[model samples]
Target: MITTDLNIKFYTYIYKCHPHLFSSLARDGQIMGLSLRVRRRGGSGSKKEIIPVTSCSEEVEITVPSQFQCPISYELMKDPVIIASGITYDRENIEKWFESGYQTCPVTNTVLTSLEQIPNHTIRRMIQGWCGSSLGGGIERIPTPRVPVTSHQVSEICGRLSAATWRGDYAACSEMVRKLKMLGKESERNRKCVKENGAGLVLCVCLDAFSENANASILLEEIVSVLTWMLPIGSEGQTKLTTTSSFNRLVELLRNGDQNAAFVIKELLELNVAHVHALTKINGVEEAFLKSLNRDSTCVNSLTSIHHMILTNQETVSRFLELDLVNTTVEMLVDSENSVCEKALTVLNAICETKEGREKVRRNELVIPILVKKILKITEKKDLVSVMWKICKSGDGYEVEEALRLGAFKKLVVMLQVGCGEGTKEKVTELLKMMNKVMKMNGFVDRSDSSSIEFKHVKKPF
Candidate 1:
C-alpha cells in the first residue's frame, strides 16, 4: 500500500504525482496562505514520512484595467491602489485606499498599506525630494534665473547642498544664492508646511555662509536660528548668553521681540548662567527703557516672562521697581479673560517671589487677601501654586488661617503630600503648621469641634 506521513503542508504547491494519484490534503493557518505535510510510500511504522512540499502566496502584480475608475473622483488613479485582501475588493474604489504617506485605512483604522509592501515606483519618485538627500549627498543642483530664495527655488538649493562642489568657492554658489533670493519672494505663496520649513533650511545655510564672513546685510535673526541648529554646540553651559562683543548686537536684536526679533531673543534666552549675567548687563538698557516708559500690560507681560531668567543685575531689579509693577498687576488678577488674566497673574507671581520683589514696594494689604480668596475659590492649575504660595506668605493677619478653612489645606497638601520633590513640599508643610498654630491661638478653631484643629503650640512642657 502506498502510504506516507507528511507534516503540515502549504495551501498551494507543486506536488509529486503517483500512479492512480491520491488526493491532496487541505491546508489551513492564520494567514490566507498554504503549508505542507508529507508521508512516505508504504514502509515500516518507524520514520515512514515523505519530505514536506513548499508553498507560496506571493502578491501577484497586475495591470490595472483602464476601465477601472475611482468611484469618488471618476478618474484614473493618480497612482495605483491596493484593495482589501478579504473584504469586497472593489476595483472602482481602489484609488481611495492609497494615500501618499499614511498607512492607516481611513475607514477601519486597520493598516492596509504597509510601507514595505508598496512597489509602485512612480508613486515613490513623485514625493522624493530631488535635492541630494542628507544621506550621501543625494541632492541634485538645478540652475535658475536670479531671484530671491523661496519655496519654488528650494528644490534647486537642496540639489546643490548634495553636490561635490557645494562650497562658497564654487561658481554654482552665487546662482544658488540668487535662486534662493527669488524663492524668498515666492515663499508667501508656498502653502505646505514642509516646503516652508525647507525654505527655512535654505535661508539657514545662506545665512551661515554670509555670517561666517560677517555678512552685514544678511538678516540677523535668521542666522541665529540657523546657528541654533547648525552652530557647534558648546559645553552644556558654555555658550555665551550676552557677549559684550555680541551684547550690543543682541540688544539691537531685542529692540523688540517683533516677528524679526523672536529668534535672536530666544538665543539670548538660551545663554548659560554666566551668559545670563551678561544678558542682565545688556538688558539693563531695556530695563531703563521699561522704567522710563509706561507700557500697558502687553509690554509688561512679554518682558516679565523672559526677564525672570535674568537674576543677576541690580539694574534689572531697579527697573522693575521703578515701574511699580506689583500694583499694576492687580487688574489682571481681577480680569475675566483667560490668557490675559493668566499672563498678568504670571508676571505678578514671578515678581512677588523674587528677593528683589520682596524689597520692592508691597501691594496694599487688601490685594493679597483678594488673590488668596481667588486662589481658594477656583480650580488650581500647577502653575498657579507658586503664585499662591508666594502671596500667602506675605498675607498679614487671619488671611492665612482663613485660607486653611477654605480648603487651602488640601491644596497645600496636594502640593506637599503628593508633590514630587523635598524642597517646596517641606517648605509648604512648615508654612501650613505655622499658620495652624497662629490660627488656633487667635481662636479661629473651636477647641471642642472635631475639625482636626488641634493647636499644640499653646501647650508647653514643664
Candidate 2:
C-alpha cells in the first residue's frame, strides 16, 4: 500500500525496493545509479562492469578506468557518474550528468544548477524512456525538431551595421563588419534577406560616406566584396534612390566612389560573374568556397552557395562540370538529409543547364539516378521541382527530345504515380502538360521545327 495527496495507491513487494530499484523516481538534484563503464581509473580502482540504468538498452558494458572507485556504490573500477562535480566512479551516466557538475547543459543553454531537472525536452524524454523500459513498458523515442533561421535577424544586424557607419563609429562599424565578413556568401540567413530587399537597406547604410573615409573604405570594401561575390542580385539604380537596372550596382558603387578601385576591384574580378560579380577577393574566393564543400563536415548553406556559384557562373562552373566535380557532387547526394541532397541536385541542374552542362551530365550516368531519388523524397519534392524544371528548360529541341528518349521522363512519372494520397500527383501532371505547351509555343512542334518530333512519355504520370 502507498499513500499520497493524490490518493493514488499501489502495492509492491519489499524485495523490489532499493535505491537502485527506484533511482528513477528521484525528482532532481539527487545522485542515483552507477554505470560501470567507459571512464577508467589509473590510480585508485580496478576493472568492473555494471549495466547502465539510464540507457534504454537492456545492457551496455562500461569499462571503468583504473584507480577510480565509487564511494556511494562502494564499487571499484566502475562507471563514473556526474553529480555537481562530485564524480562517483560507481555511478550511471545520467546520475553523473544530473549531479549538476556541468556549467551549462549540452542540449539547453541553461546552467545545470539553476534547474531541478534538465531543461531540454530531448534529455527529459530520454530519461523517461529509459525509466519506462525498466518497468517493462515500451519506451517512446521523441524526435528533436530543427530551428529555422529568419530574415528579420539579418535586417536587424544590418540596421546596426549601417547606424554604426553613419556616426563615424569606426570601432563599432569594424566589429559589425568582421561579423558580417565571417558570415560571408555561405549564410542562408543573410542571402535570403538580400533576396527579400531587407539586406539592401544594410548595404545602403554601409555605402554612405564609405568612399570618403579611408578606414571605412577598407572595411566596407571587405564586406561588400563578399556580398557582391556571392549575392549577384542587381538592377541599375535599383537602390531605393535609383532607376537604372545595371546588374553591378554594388561593384559599381565601389569602383565609382572614392574607393581605391585598384585595391578591391582587382580582387573582385575573380568572382562568379554570372551570379554575384560585385565581390573582389584578390586572394581568390573560388578556392575558399570549394574547400568548404570537401570538408569532413559540410554545412547545408555552404553547399548551397557552391551550387549557386556553379550555376550562375558559366566559365568557372565549366570547371565543376568536369569528371571530378560531377563525381564528388554525386557522392554528396548520398547524404540522407533532404536539404543536402536537394542542394546536390541543384548543382547537377546547373551542370545540365546549357549545351556544355547537358554534355557533362550525359557523360556521367550517376547524376540521373541520384536526381530521381531526390525528386522521390515526398516531403522534399517542393525544393527539387524548381531545379528539375530548370534542367528540363535548358534543353534545346534536340536535347529535350534526347533527354526524354533517355528515360528522364520515366523517372519523373514514377514520382507522380506513387504520390501518397496528396494532390501532388495532379500537380506534377499539370507541370508536364505545361512543358508540352511550352514546346509548342517555342515552335518546337510548329511547321518551323522540322526536326521537332513528338515524344510520347506515357502521359499518365509524367
lDDT of 2 by residue, 1-462 (tens): 123322211112211345354344333513223221233334443633222233223334443323233444433322233333333233343445445565554434455563222123333344444434533223233333222224555566677877887787777777866655555444554455344645554654455445445445566556555444334334321232121221233334433442332222332233334224322221234444444456532345444555555545667566555425666666676554766776666666666666776655554544434454455453666545544455445544443443343444555566677663355455466556654665566644322222232323222110
Worst 10 residues of 1 by lDDT: 1-10
Candidate 2, TM-score vs. the true structure?
0.33
Best by lDDT: 2
Report the Cα lDDT for residue 233, model 1.
36
Deviation from native of the Cα of residue 98 in model 2, angstroms? 44
Q: TM-score of every model?
A: 0.43, 0.33
User: How many pairs of residues collide in each model?
Assistant: 43, 41
